[model samples]
Target: MNTKMFCYQCEQTVGCTGCTGNAGVCGKKADTARLQDELTGALIGLARAVDGAETISKRTSQVIMEGLFTTVTNVSFDDAAIETMIQKVRAEKERLVPDCSKCQSSCGKTDEYDMQQLWDANEDVRSLKSLILFGIRGMAAYAYHANVLNYEDAEVNRFFCEALFKIGYEESVETLLPVVLKVGEINLKCMALLDKANTETYGTPEPTAVTLTVEKGPFIVVTGHDLKDLQLLLEQTEGKGINIYTHGEMLPAHAYPFLKKFSHLKGNFGTAWQNQQKEFDHLPAPILYTTNCLMPPKSSYADRVFTTEVVAFPGAVHIDEKKDFTPVIEKALELGGYKEDQILTGINGGTKVTTGFGHAAILSHAGTVVEAVKAGAIRHFFLVAGCDGAKPGRNYYTEFVKQTPSDSIILTLACGKFRFNDLDLGEIGGLPRLMDMGQCNDAYGAIQVAVALADAFGCSVNELPLSFVLSWYEQKAVCILLTLLHLGIKNIRLGPSLPAFLSPNILNFLVKNYGIAPITTPEEDIKTLLNHNK
Candidate 1:
């Protein structure tokens, strides 16, 4: 196999196999892919170095988390940025064991492990290790967000090094399998950490209606999953005569009291991240990407794109840690937005969408929900959530939501909801049939709600008429799915595609033990789920 690179970390990989040519399906070039692999290998070596240290510092864990996050699909595409990350990993290793590299004995313990070894390993081993690696990469994103908000969990931080060390050196199935499942266990804690950070900082999200109308004036469109970046932007742009609109995963920011207080924080701008290139074409407003799901910018609106945090693209203005929004604001003002309010609608052609149904908001009405459930007003619950991508079969989600029985409640998170979120599913017993539960990290809230429901009903979650019809695209979805599996949840129907990295043996194990299966047609799956619920 004479290939330029090997990458299957995302669901949209080439032909459901690895992306081995010049660029990945996410538009990451081969050079960038190679640099990311190198960065991962370097992080592994740093983890190995930390293993010998008496203690792991917060900074050490932070670097490990950042490095892992940097390699997640569609994140850092800049070779220079990836190389800088590699250097940061090495610098962290040197800080931990200054004299180790200077040793004449030259033990391989501290040397960077080549990622190609893992990529070329036995099928089952590769599958399991990929699960662990991808799961933590997703977990790191949550941990990073929480860390920015001054939340730190020593256990979560330590597991980064432990997972990296195992990925680099461990080969036994017995050893790696538990580590793979443990990624899910740790990620649950990480999501909870992020949940605490978000709710405490921004205030617990409440149900709020976010319009799709872009008010006339200078406006900046904020996308990706960073609420802190959105808050900072909201603060800096307040009273600047510039309106702010949430895009993609940032749509949940509107539900936060601290964020919604900004009068200029008008409404949502666009749909999921995959549609950005089309949606952003010649957009008059500046678009700021605070995190991943960034596509290669088309020349039309390339000049209006600004990246902050770990997100970097060549030639686009990069916002450093100083968090200044001058350039973005100035761009917004210069572009002079629409002459009139541009009314945008979701894919389902609805002008308004609602969000902020976090655990607190949902649980606040738990008594009502419980009464409805027991009275048969709400027959079942469907968690139709996960990442959205530019793929063919994703219409399955839109159709699935539409075909879901009127008596069932649709609990959604992440961008996948963009498919049918705007459709009027009506309400069940005073509650909207569809509830958007924040971002993908807000999967924590969904889990909390499920567990609470189960406790109220005196049964396990799997026995509570709840079904997970998830659509995954990238690593974040991977970690969330693993978290579900870790909790002993069963019969999850995942699509638009299963991960390419899953070997037949590992897939069989999951199918046999966990009852995980790829999604079939929405009509068939809905009928099957309803029948199963009965």
Candidate 2:
């Protein structure tokens, strides 16, 4: 147990369990991991101190959300950046508990939590707390995006402190269980907040085809999921002879009317975050990461990497809150882009992909979709969504989406769509069968579509001919999945593997109660889901 690093918070942990070595399977160093733990512990302390607020201020909530989300897997790797976050949380804690240290009797009201204690706790308890902790981390991303747009939900913000306090203070598995599910409940609110923030700020997304080709010339590749940053960059880069290409979760930006207005804002650069190391290695463009799913940069591409907001690597250029992307612009121009226009296809080898199918767009065509169902043109709907990763078995998503019957429509979100997004799925009733439903936070939109369809069909969502085949790699996906479970949605297929954080008993409980199962072959799953639909 005296390991240099102890982390199993992600799907890519060493030995398919915990990483107890010098480096994590995701390329996080022990030093960075320790700092992340400290950041998390400090955030938990802030949460503990600020507990029971009559009304949680947006500023306190912002700090809590950023601190929690910053510690999510593969988010931040710089010890310095994490230390800064630790300081922010500590300052907030001090602001809340000015007199706690001067009290006559000692009260450990806001003591910083030791993450190792949670890691070392009993298996079931650890599993529940992990769900609560990780779920909020995911929820925080949505909350962060919302806050960036001046949209804040007090309830969703309050739940963060409540959940973090539970992680630091509550000991019972029974006590942690409901809070674990409440993470799902509150995340639904968080996602809804983000959905409103985005649709209101950027306008409702419509289906838009995004080119995979990176145009010849100086261009900066923006990754992660911050739309505001992308918009600001687009504004700054406009007519600068510098093309801006979206990458990772930012691919959905191409569908936003406001962003797409920038003609020089070019296409997407890479598939998912996991491929950045390989994809950016030979790239002549600088990559600006605005959020998570950032891999530790390889030496070859390290210099081309720029991080902003909560994302960081030790040596990469850090864009401050001013949103001035000049460093990334300068880096991209220095790289001089390509000798000729570079055509980049997705993993499927298709030249283009479509996105922008948020809730409003989907519901606008709701009547047609419903009529198609009645006409038997669309027999089923598969919500094949969640984060994409580098694991071998992730091809299951591609195969699953590909193997879905022609009569079935695929509703997708997040970066996982890169697997088959390039593949032309054709159309059913004048609607593209493969509909991209914005970013991971837009899982709220997917939920809305599901609910609307159920309401139109006069049946429970579980009774509808819909299936959820999700692939999770990090905390955001965890919260989205929890939101699903919170809605009492059943018969979900999660893969390429279940989380290591879920103990045998806790996993068993999920299976028995929810009918959630790990994905098998695409053929087998398709058949099972089709039969279940019958």
Candidate 3:
């Protein structure tokens, strides 16, 4: 029960359980892990203080969401940054309950809960509460992104505090069960909020073709899922004799009209976040990460990594609220990029990829899509998307997409699309069969497509010939999965592996009630999914 660092929140937890040593499997140091725990504890106290009648401040919302998200898997590796977030949480708590500190009588009513107690609790209770805690951590990232664009939902904003309150106060399994599922319910709204913010600010993403070439010139490669950060960086770097390339989750930025208006905004550079160490090694450009999916930098690229917002790594230059891009710009100029245009390809070796199939874009062509299905030109639909990771088993997604029937369409989002997005999948009704729906939070868009399809056919979502084959790496995927289950979508095929935190009882319940199963080979699972239609 005495563990220095215990983290089992993601698909890559060491030994399929917690990482209880120097670092987690994802390269988080022991000290960083402890700071994350401290951050969580402080966030809980902040949430507890704001639980009742007080109208939570906008800054309080930002701090709650950003602090929780900062602790997600690979998002923040800087202990100093994490401590700063902890201080923000404490300040917010004091702002909410100013009298608690100065009162003479002893009272422990609003004190921060020690994380060790939760870690040492009964396994089932811990598992349920963990779901609530981890699920919201993922939701917070989406909320933060939306908040940056001046989009805020009162219900979605309050849920963070409520969920954190439950995580800190509710101990019994029965009381926590509903709260655990509420995280899923709230996350859907949070994702929708982000979708509105992004689309309104950047325009609905259209099906635009993006190249994998790094144009000749000094350039900056931007990664992560924050479009607002990308937008500001694009504005700052315009007309500076530099090219801008998207990488990882930022690939979809190229499809947004508002961003693509910048002529210097070039093409995408590398693949998913997991490949950064190899992809960025000795690169002639600086990388500005706007959010999560940052690996611990290799010394080769350590000096070139620039982080903004909640994404911080030790020794990397951080851009604060000032949104200054001077350091990143100077680094790019010093590196002086390739002498000539360099072509890059995805893992499957295609020179170009296509994205921007947001819900509005797809539904705008809904009549044509429905007719194609009626004419038997399209046989089925598959959502083969989620977060990507370093595990070799992730190749399953690539193979699954590759082996899908030519008449079927693959709707993908998040970094997982890097596995198969570069491949040409042909088209039906002017829409490529393989459609990229932006980042993970764009799961909101995917859900919209599903609901629209169901309404068009006058049947339930599960009644439609659609299958979900998901690959999860982090907590964002957890919230999305819970949202799917909340919608009563059944028989999902999840892999590279199930999460390590789910207790035997919780896992069994998911299987029995939701018909969720771990994925087998692409060949067998695809056949099973296709057969279900008959």
Which candidate do you rate higher for lDDT, 2 or 3? 3
Candidate 2 residue lDDT tens string, 1-534: 134998877887776788988888887788888888888988888888877777888789889988987888878888888889999988888888886545677466688889989988999999999888888988888888889999999899888889989998888888998998898888988888888888889887888988888878898888888999988888888777899888888988888888878899778887888887888887888888899978888888888888899998888989999888888888877989898987778887988888988888999999999999999999999999988888899999999988999999999998888888988888998999999988888889989999999999999999999999999999988998888999999999998889989999999989998999999999999999999967
lDDT of 1 by residue, 402-495 (tens): 9899999999999999999899999988899999998999999999999999999999998889999999999999999999999999999999
What C-alpha lDDT values do all the predictions have?
0.91, 0.88, 0.89
Ranking by lDDT: 1, 3, 2
Model 2 global lDDT (CA atoms, 0 to 1): 0.88
**How many pairs of residues collide in each model?**
0, 0, 0
> Higher-TM-score candidate among 1 and 3?
1
Estimated TM-score per prediction? 0.98, 0.97, 0.97
Determine the C-alpha RMSD for candidate 3 after optimal superposition of all C-alphas.
1.6
Model 2: CA > 4 A from native: 1-3, 99-105
How good is model 2 by TM-score? 0.97
